[model samples]
Target: MEHSITVKQQEVQKRLADLTLQQSRLSMIPGFSGQINAGYSDGRTNDIVTNQYINQSIFNASGQLSMGGDIFNWFSKQNTIAANRLDAESNSFLLQKARNDLAFNVATAFLQILLKTEQVKVNEVQVHQTLSNLDNTKKLVIAGSVPESNQADLEAQLAQDSTNLVTAKNDVILSILQMKAYLNLGFDIAFVPEIPENVSSLPITPLGEMDPEMVYSAALTTYPLVKSDELRIKSADKTFRATRGQLYPALTIGGGLSTGYANNFYDRNMKLVPFGQQIDNTFNKNIGLGLRIPIFNGYQQRTAVSKAKVNVYNMQLNRDLDNQKLRQDIYTAHANAVAALQKYNASATGVMAAQKAYDFATKRFNLGLMNTIDYITTQTRLFKAQIDKVSAQYDYIFKMKLLEFYRDQRISL
Candidate 1:
């Protein structure tokens, strides 16, 4: 017994499945940046600073040497990171919506399957009752209390009951199969859901705690859709600023040290110094500064600024629309949940009465006080009541979940 698997081990397959799904939504930015540059100038390698003793020209106005992010590049990079995270956020929202829908649908259908199974049991009992009645009727016919013709009628009735039981059994089997399919589970291992004992015992209509304004506010300020749009707006603003940066002048300042030798430890410019003299030193130093502003570049930066502004406006409109939709959804769900819960509570009494009627009719028919058709009529009524009661159960459950979805309470399976 001690060698058996742990609870965590038993749940390993489930954990992997959940991880795989979450991983699909998860996204990460590199958190990485780098820049590299190398170049050479034709003359005076040592003069790397200016009159003010400031550093100059590690960079140049020389040949075209393109490199990585200056300040504009850095801002653009930050914007890109934000954009990627927002995209992941929006995707996560959609996945959450799907999860809610799946949970609601499974609960509804599973309840239906349970109700249908109960119905099959009721019908099966009726069929057996009819079979017993038919056998007795045959014996009575032989004893002359009923005529020979009654025996034939009894047998025909028995045959009909058998047919109906077979059909009902088929329905139960089909329902179970559907429940298995919805759960994404294999039917190799039999699964049976525990049905609720009484519909009246379920939660009643909940009072509306949120108004339309609250729903809209939450959607605009807290919902993933609005957050994604806000991220895009921030990115667009950064892009606009970065593009405008091209209009301003770029400033650079640098410095360097160099030493030269010409067949000896002496600079060519310092060649006049006597050999073997301490004056024959070979060293140089330099400093500089540079500035360049773009006069024009075929209006590319202007176009980019325009596009960024347009995107900002478009996103604003989209976010507003999303807020409106969120409000409408909450209203609908709240109303439905309230109505369904009340209706479900009211339907419980009908189900009880129907059950009593079916039981009474069955007893009366067996005691020779009621006909087979009367018992069957009661059976149909009971079936309808059961179906209605189950339907209301699911309707209430679905609406409750919908309410929970709006409240940001959807987490547990």
Candidate 2:
């Protein structure tokens, strides 16, 4: 799960969500700015105290600190922050869902490897049985109890069994490669999958206990995908409100402190004012409130409001769709589990029947009462039945595991 690309992407998404939430929070506070300026003026300018135009070369310095913020904008900032908070929460759920999905994929690959390994073992057993039969057939041919043709047929059957064994081994190798890909391991690495002694003994929730409706009900609250979608809908609603708030009037508060000094400044007595005294006299402080009523700006605000409204509707629809899909998936998994159980039961009965027939055929062939063709056919049937049983058992196990994963958001074995 940690090696999965999707999990890595989710990690990056979670970080971005956190950053977006932080940015929205920062927007709630007022903004401040400060500036300092100094220059030598050589042209005519107005005197600060006399308020009269005068021709003079003056050295001037000024500085200002100011702050401004929207005191009220129909709760736009608050709603935006709420929206971002919801988004961050939604992303967290999505990240968890990604992890769960990756884990399930790994489990599936591991199960595939196990299944292929079982097939290889079955094929190996078939090959050994065929070789043993060939040896017995050779003795019968040498004694003239069976014709030379019987030995030739057994040899051909042995060759086919060997070929089948080779193919099954190749399949196991391919399955192991697939598992390695899931683990993000290098193909060149010699890897051996640890097979459980008894996969059938792995823990699973009983099929009878997994009612489709009950599972769906539980999933609605427990599934991360559903939770994420629900949160996204709320986030969209908050965003709509924030966007709509932009179309209304806003109230803002601002304040500033500024002071300036000019070397050319003089008092009413016609004496040059000292620089320090000039700075003190020129100091000013002011505060004010402003109202801004949005008229029209190429319909940008209205367009944004319309888009936001549409987004809310889309989010709601998406949530509904996701819920529907979840229900369908749960029901489908339950159905598949039922089918797999039935198949496993049928395959088990077939293997038992085939085993009995093969045992009888073996006795008849040893007594020289059954032909080589008939004996080989019975053995092949038994082999196929055993393979089918193994396949069905694994299929049933995987299906049950899938349903259990849906219920618990985790998989074991």
- Runs in model 1 deviating more than 4 A are 1-226, 243-300, 356-371, 411-413
Which lDDT tens digits does candidate 2 get at residues 1-413? Answer: 66777788998999999999999999878999999999997878887777889888988799999999989999998999999999999999999998888889888888888898999999989989989988988998899998988889989999999999898989889988887887788899999978999987778788999998988888887899999998999999999999999999999999999999878777788788998898789899999999999998999999999999999999989999999988899899999999999999999999999999999999999889999999999999999999999999989888888887888888887
Measured by TM-score, the strongest candidate is: 2
TM per candidate comes to: 0.55, 0.87
Q: How close is candidate 2 to the true structure, as a TM-score?
A: 0.87
User: Model 2 clash pairs?
Assistant: none
- RMSD (CA, Å), candidate 1 to true, equals 11.4
Please give the lDDT score at residue 135 for candidate 2.
Answer: 94
Worst 10 residues of 1 by lDDT: 60-69
Q: What is the C-alpha RMSD of each candidate to the true structure, in Å?
A: 11.4, 3.7
lDDT value, residue 200 of candidate 1: 47
